[model samples]
Target chain A: MDAAAHDTHDAHDEPHLTPYSVYVGIWLALIALTGVTVLASVVDMKHQAIFVALFVATAKSTLVVLYFMHIAFENRVFWWFLLSAIATFVIFVLLTFADYAYR
Target chain B: MSSDTAMPDLPETNYINAEKGLKSWLTTIDHKRIALMYLIAIGGFFVVAMGLGFMMRLELLNPGEQFLDGAAYNRVLTLHGVIMIFLFIIPSIPAVFGNFCLPIMLGANDVSFPRLNLASWYFYIAGAIVALFSVAAGGVDTGWTFYVPYSANTDANVMLPMFAAFLLGWSSILTGLNFIVTTHRLRAPGMGWRQMPLFVWGIYATSWIAVLATPVIGITLVLVLIERYMGIGIFNATMGGDPILFQHLFWIYSHPAVYVMVLPAMAVVSEIVPVFSQKRIFGYRFIAMSSIAIAAIGSLVWAHHMFTSGMADEGRIIFSFLTFFVSVPSAVKVFNWLATMYKGSIKVDPPMLFAFAFIFLFSIGGFTGLLQGALSVDIHLHDTAFIVAHFHYTMFGGTGVMFFGAMYYWWPKMFGRMYNRTMAYVGFAMFFVGFNTLYFPLFIAGLKGMPRRYADYLPEYHSYHALSTVGSWIMVTGILILFANLIWAIKRGKRAERNPWGGATLEWAVASPPATHQFDGPPEVGEPYDYKIPHLGDDESAGSGADEGKA
Candidate 1:
């Protein structure tokens, strides 16, 4: 394949570049989520704090994957592959926890 | 067709002759060169580890110490396991063939990240140096798995090996990432995902497992290093940390790692069986999807290794059930291979002989795996020679045999030369016979209650040990003959034709050794395993000619 042709192919399908303001907004949202995680850790509602911290961290990372990593603009297959990897990791953690929970 | 007419004259300039000087190879980003570099490194490690294994077997020839004391034996065993698993088998297929063939098979010029591919090789070398350094500094006694508490408590230089493994894990992750991206982005303009060669699909699946599971082990090893150096309470039982947690984490990567080892071999079999059998691959989609299925399902079955490691009954049952289901995908592959060969005009070349051996030996390995999948039976078989036998059968017999098979199948193309056919067969016979002789007795010895990893055995198990020791000698002799044949053939072997096996894959469409830029232009994409297409005749350059003219 021609080098120019490959570059053109990539450029043709490229998503409209996300505006800098939107990236800044996503960055600010991540910071806010981190603050919430810190707040939850400090003011622990016992076991609920763990859940709150996890939720905020997940939200923060999801935001990073979407806008920061540009995964939001990737093809559907890319999304599925990422989802499957995350699902496999979650299953490993859950299955191990199964033993710990019963014990 | 006469053999003289069938073999085409060698290309005037191929990848090997495209450049000159040692620095060119060191700096070249060509995947083929990198693959050769990997072949040298991986082959070197295999020989070293094989010697260590043979020595260990020699020690077990008697009831007591022969040459190595218990400490020396432990270190040798540890190095053998560590080098074989991390250095040799894990990178064997993907690093060598995958780097060389994947992009060409995809009809592309190179991997998506060429420099990163080079860096992965450097990471491998760096990690290998650290591992060798650890050995020189009074080798670690912890087994390859580096099970916790023992690893943390070992006064030997465990930290270097752990860090070494961590670095090697990064190399694995980078290689996986490179392949994943190259497959997604760099395929020829017309080649669809479904149209890819099954070997590419196999690597694609294995890469995902590499990207996902390797990082867990990398982090686990880092934690182990920290625990040892700083006396952290992670996997140390007395420090209120759970040692079982270490097993869970280590196996989380190591178990799926077995699939990492075998899937590419299976992929090679998938490619070789169809070409040599003169038929289309039976159930191509099924075989491709099964690779993915094995990767996904294989990850879940890691805890099967921990059945007797004080895992809860419920966990054991769940893992056992998952383990049984994991076999389904493997069986699908086996059945498809047999079906592909059922009615076809099969050529029993060296590669095919090894493939057939792979099926037979891998079947035994798989069935024995099922035996251990049974929670009740596994408890009895756990930590015994049976487990050791099962692992070698699947690994050495399955992946190891197929690795040699792939070497035979691709040897001509990689080096533009042919090995002595009679010597090839002689070597194969010795390897197949010696491999069985070496491992099969271990199965019997395990059933007779011989524990593995022991420096000594009881008198009742002495016969089995003696037989196994002799078998190791035979096996090593076979391996030596095989290597010697290939080495001698490199200089003296006949020049090979472009498509010697009449393979339909894109790699065969190029020059025997391939060009530095594999394709002059975009390669013509077609069904990868269609044997009905005439070999090295009319359509050989349908895509190449047009692309060359345009270029």
Candidate 2:
């Protein structure tokens, strides 16, 4: 039962060159985002600053997850696994807000 | 060819069976051996905790100046809760059955990282030793929750045990990570997600929660310890730290922690229900999804625990409704388990008996939980035995009963031996009867205004307290018998076939006490659970060979 025997149709074998520049650009963008987040947190923006900081953090994490973790290039099955975690986070944070909002 | 005759001869017993001794147990790295060690360690701790419970009951038995000081009783009760929650119940099902079964169920030789698995056991043991030191040194009376200013302010030796708990949580997170990675990467080639047995799903869900939420508790405990020792500015309010922040952080992990405790029990029930009923689960997808839903919803409901802890009125209202919402998924599971049994061929094995008990007891627990979620009701039942009784019914009756059932249910598969069925039934009866007697009265006493964690209670609650103590003894007796039965079965019982319960899961397709490499060949990837699938008896289908390498 050689598993590779069943892998004649490999998904990663698609013709696509994700270039070195793509990685360099992503790193630069991430560094810029972190600077913005830190600057935003310092301004007396109050609760708005907190949300901005979280949003920026989320963006940075997304970039890391997609490129560094290679989740973006992974299979649909892997996406399903990753999305489940995202969905759980959404539910946790939103449902909490639902309480906060209603109250 | 004469090659067969020239083949190297090996010893009769290799590393696994050679020279059985205490040394073999302590230093050995075999997952089964490590799991057995965990079983013994946690079992001993369970006894110690229950003994503490007995002492509490005795003090309550006579009410005033019965056996120990007010502080001593408080300390013992706190230690009992902490030990049972952290040391015993949380790890009981997962570490024991999960370690033993995960590889077998995946049709793999071992966990993806067996050394990590072994390291977890060592971490567990070290944590246990520290916990015992805390207990011996007059114990910390902060309750298992270790609520804010009190925990930080307590002079009783606190930092060491809090550190122990913090380390234990990391150990739990590592174990969770190990399981998640193994279950994902190590399944046999043809084993798909849908093809996985429900117990695996249960563990997978539990692992996810363990990985994500345990960090919060780990940090919380660290903060608490730092506050206690170095006078840190985290949870302590005098240093501009909000005590409410402590409650928030604690429940963030503690609430999800209940799911960690209960999901595996639910998973065990899912596996047992189908086998005992001789039916495929009514809706496998629903059951599996509900586990994920419960884990997700469970994390958000932590605020409900703090409804009366002086959060804003808005926070209270929001948490109250979210609490009810979390109950929806839990109720879905309860209904699904019951529906799985409807019109199916139900067997009355001890495992099923306990699953039935879980359904009843967890329902009581869940409903009582909803009662507490009501801000009005919680204001009254805040520190009462009702809350204590509610959790016991859930954690003890729900998780503990399911754990025992799972042990009996999977014992044959685990040890390749059959336990004495009559003894199993007797143990189940005593446990169920004694369990209801013990906790049900607490619910009554609680509602009638008996606060929990008290060394002395009003005279009116005296008779019920005595009855409860008697009930605890009966429950303890049942556990002793249950332990004996399993031990005897392991050494002396009749050998088991591959699928004693006729389960269609991948685990049952392998050998009883599966070989080092689990599958004879590739997993027979058929329907995971389909009552309609035709079955051949074990004897006729037992000729699969091991040499054919799996992909």
Best candidate per DockQ, number?
Answer: 1
For each of the candidates, the C-alpha root-mean-square deviation to the true structure, in angstroms, is 3.3, 5.9
Each candidate: chain B TM-score: 0.97, 0.93
After TM-score superposition, the amount by which residue B243's alpha carbon in candidate 2 deviates from its true location, in angstroms, is: 0.7
Show where candidate 2 strays beyond 4 Å. Answer: A1-103, B1-30, B531-536, B539-551
True-contact fraction for model 1?
A: 0.56
For candidate 1, lDDT tens digit of each residue in B286-387?
A: 999999999989998899998888988888889999999999999999999999998998999988998999999999999999999999998899899998
TM-score of chain A of 2: 0.75
lDDT tens readout by residue for model 2, B1-551:
01112222222332235448888777766666667777788888888998888788777777688879988877888889889999998889889888877766676667777788878888888888898898778788888878889888878877777777887887788889888988899887788888888888899899999988888788888888777778778877788787877887787888899999999999989888988898878788888889989987788888887767667787788778878998887888788888889999998877788889889988999899989989999999988989889999999988888878888888876666778888888887888888888888999999999998888888999877888888888887888889899999878777665466777776676545544455555665666666444442342343221321221
Label model 2 with its docking quality class: acceptable
Isolated chain A: TM-score per model? 0.81, 0.75
What's the DockQ of model 1?
0.59
The per-residue C-alpha lDDT of model 1 at residue B61 equals 90
